[model samples]
Target chain A: MIGVLLLTIRELRAKKIILGLFGVATLVWVVLALALRLDVIEGSLAGARLFGEEMSGDSDLTDELGEPALGNSLLETFVFGAEMFAAGAAYWVGILLALFATGGLIASMLQQGQVDLLLTKPLSRSKILAGRLLGVSVVMLALLTYLLGAVWLVMSIKTGIWNPRFLLAISVVFVMFMVLYSLISLTSVWTGSTPLSLILTFGLLFASLILAIKPLHEQITQPGRSIVVGLYNILPKFVDVGAHIVPQLVVGETVESWFPFVSSLAFGVVAYALAFRLFQRKDF
Target chain B: MPASAISVKGLSKTYNSAFGKQEVHALRPLDLTVNEGEIFGLLGPNGAGKTTLVKLLLGIVHPTEGSGELFGISIRSPEARKAVGFLPENHRFPEFLTGRETLDLYARMSGTTDMDRANKSEELLERVRLTGSAHRRVKTYSKGMMQRLGIAQALMSNPKLVFLDEPTDGVDPVGRREIRDLLLELKAEGVTLFLNSHLLSEIERVCTRVAILKEGRLVREGTVEELTTQDRIWRLRSTPIPDQSLGDHAHLVSDAQSNGLSEYRLHAADRTALNASLDHLRLAGVEIESVEPLRQSLEELFIDVVEDAST
Candidate 1:
């Protein structure tokens, strides 16, 4: 097992495409977080001033006022800004990062015949597949760590009060990314081609998200509410994790929902095991 | 002496294809044995089942019928594989790894744990003359370099027997000579080499014994001298002697004049009769310049075997 792991690490180091993609992913996450922080600052200051004026019962704070008063403390504004950024950008970043990293890792190995080389070794087929999965998982974790640290640093400079719950949200987001990456890795092996694997992974994610939204949309006087609800039950509700985490962090609400986490982990493990078995049976 | 390095009895293989399931009896129930410390050559033309035999020995492809043993272990058993090293024809390796790394990986996989795999890798690289470029990626290496690396990897585990399929297929003249020398060195070290190649000159030069296959059947098998001796041919050159004055039993095979010299090849039943005929010609005042037996070249022998089998 260690031999397979060392060999996998060596192969990954030799591949420039994976390294370049990871670098680009890190840069994009940092930039998005920074931009989101700015928007949150602007939006929060405007919202707080509107609320304070209404509470003060000032006649001059009329309904016709185009601009609301700026908030008093920069720290309060920054925390509000960071929370807003997490709600809007976290899911998209997680999904894309998972897809790109997992897809690129599998494709690069296949294209270079690395898997063939590793299998020719004395190591078992399962160990080789597991080593690759482990490597990709580590890379995802590292990138998530970097992104979380960057976001917290930017937000900390703007806001005095540091929220540990924001860090916890990032950790949950990393776990979600890992589940998605495992699915993509398995699909890449199953499909045996890069473009096709990426397409299937993205297609499944999109389908799941769309299905999760149908129940809410159908309740607004739409027909086929039962069918939408059935789909909502069948498809994975990945967005619920983010929705649940963000609200608990911002509103101080402790909600319990471990089903999605357990289900995603279970699916990921089974997919990985199946992919490894198929790969072992394949001639090349 | 107790056990043959390799033993194959009645080994045969058939392929099922889309064109009406054409069956090719590759081995044709052949029997073969190679003793320890001998260089055995499997000489044949294209589609002669040499590669099939090697694949069977390596357990890459299953045999349709018959069985063999390597180093006293059954061919089907995985334990038997530990004693065999194979350099497949047109074999491919991962292009991402360096030459040194390639050898190290194979050595480790072959169950050489906690040992000096790196040292073995370096030694083998130097043996194949790829030491200087050991760190360069395989993709950047030339064809000859790749072949050298392939040979190095095959020898990494120090197996009891090595199966090399066209080991010098794309090598240059110098590289071919070097590889031939290496095979001889390995043979001297008591390692059995199962060499499969169409290059009869190589087989003739290094093989202690050889077997020829045609269309998946063993057409001929013996020492180089034995195979060459099966067919008789002799070339004679002498001064002009009138055909009417020639002694009895002097049938001319070919008579030609080159640079004012006459050359004639004669067909005789035996060496004594040939000598008698040569003496009679000399006594008849036909000055003899050179009289020598023209043994069959390996190429000629190979062509004759394959062509005869086809017919």
Candidate 2:
């Protein structure tokens, strides 16, 4: 398995598309770093504004009312807003990109001529499956770390507020992806078709998000509610899990309660275990 | 005293199509044994269960009935493959990896020790005549170069038994001869080889024993000498034939005249009687120029076996 993992890592290193994703990520960070600027003001608390683009020569930092305004620190507000975008918009896009990038890994491995070389080795089917999973996971983890760390660095340099908790978002997004990728891996093993695996996993992802809504949960009958709740519990709570990251950073939310984390971890474990079983029994 | 390298009994395989709409019996119940330190060849027509049988022994496909063993270990277990090396037909490696990296990957996968891995990698690269191209990516290699690299990696572990399917399929004449020499060298080191190829002449040149299959059944199994020998025809060449005194054992032929020399085709019941006739001719002053056994080529034997099975 370790040998497989090492070789898998080598394979990922040569994938031009994955490197292009990393470049896009860095480009996004660079644009964000240059476009947004925030600073401290001694006179009016109302001067708290995140300036986007150039405001020109003589515009007052304060509003026309000339009264002290909403918040004290402009930097905290800016960091808070950026965290939301990172967690919501950027994270979801990253998930979609990952699905597109790694969707064919298992399917490609199972190709007629390719699978024969791998299966003829001295390793068990389960180990080979696990190693491939880990290889993709490590690549994703490296990408997330780079993007999150860049965001942290840019925010700290501009705002002088280095929030250590901001880094947790990397792991949060990675875990969310792991939970989703497990479903993709299982689908790949079951069908050996990349498009089918992608469609099924993405379909279940939207269904899980819709089921988590409180109003929608209320609209269903008692039996339907039970089924919805059961599925929500079993599937990784992607929206909820990603939504919780920003509050913890900007608002000092406690990590004491772990619902989606534990449940999602369990869901990923079960999916991979089932995938391993299927891969072991498969003739290819 | 050599031990059995592979032992199979009643091994079989049957594949079912989606929804059970169709069924294909890829292999029937078959029995086979391959001894250590010998090259065993498997010859078959298309869809004759040759690849299926190799996959079953390698545990790539599960057997539907019966069992097999490799080096006294159960074929169903992964450990049974620990000392085995295989070069699959139409095999593919990761295109991004270089020749050296590909060999390193297989060596590591085979769990070779650190010292032996380094030494063996270099040795194999030289043996396969790819030492100069070891650093080039496989995507840049020609088909013949890729086949050479494939063989190099298959021998990386210095395994006790190696299975090669169409190993020289795309190699040129010179490259094919080099591969044959390499196989013979490995045989000298007591490594067993299981070869499957369509090139009957190549098999005849290197294989110690061969098995021919047709429609999932073993049609013929024997040494090259046993299968191709035409025992009744003893070809004898002499200076001239003044052959009346040689008794009824000699059949003089007018068509045997060539370049003022007499070439006689003698028919005998068996090799012992053939040798007796040759001795009698020697004392009678009919100078013998050459004595040789006339036999069919491996191609002819293979065609005969497969066509006979079809009928």
- TM-scores for the candidates: 0.69, 0.86
Candidate 1: lDDT of B106?
Answer: 67
lDDT for model 2 comes to: 0.82
* lDDT for residue A137 in candidate 1, whole number 0-100: 62
Per-model lDDT: 0.69, 0.82
* Per-residue lDDT over B1-311 for candidate 1, one digit per residue giving the tens place of the 0 to 100 score: 44689999888887766595686566677788988888899988777888778767766556878999988888766668676677777767767888888888767767765566877887888899999999898999999998888888878888779888788989999999999999999998889999998788999999988999888888889888888764345666777767875655554554646744476766678888788777778778888778677678788888898888888
Name every residue pair that clashes in candidate 1: A122-B109
A33: Cα error in model 1, Å? 12
DockQ for every model, please. 0.15, 0.61
Error of 2 at B230 (Å): 4.0
Q: How many backbone clashes does candidate 2 have?
A: 1
**Residue A137 displacement in candidate 1 (angstroms):** 4.1
lDDT of 1 by residue, A162-185 (tens): 656566666667666766666667
- List ranges where model 1 is wrong by over 4 Å: A21-120, A127-192, A213-270, B7-34, B43-49, B59-69, B73-79, B91-96, B113-115, B212-222, B231-295
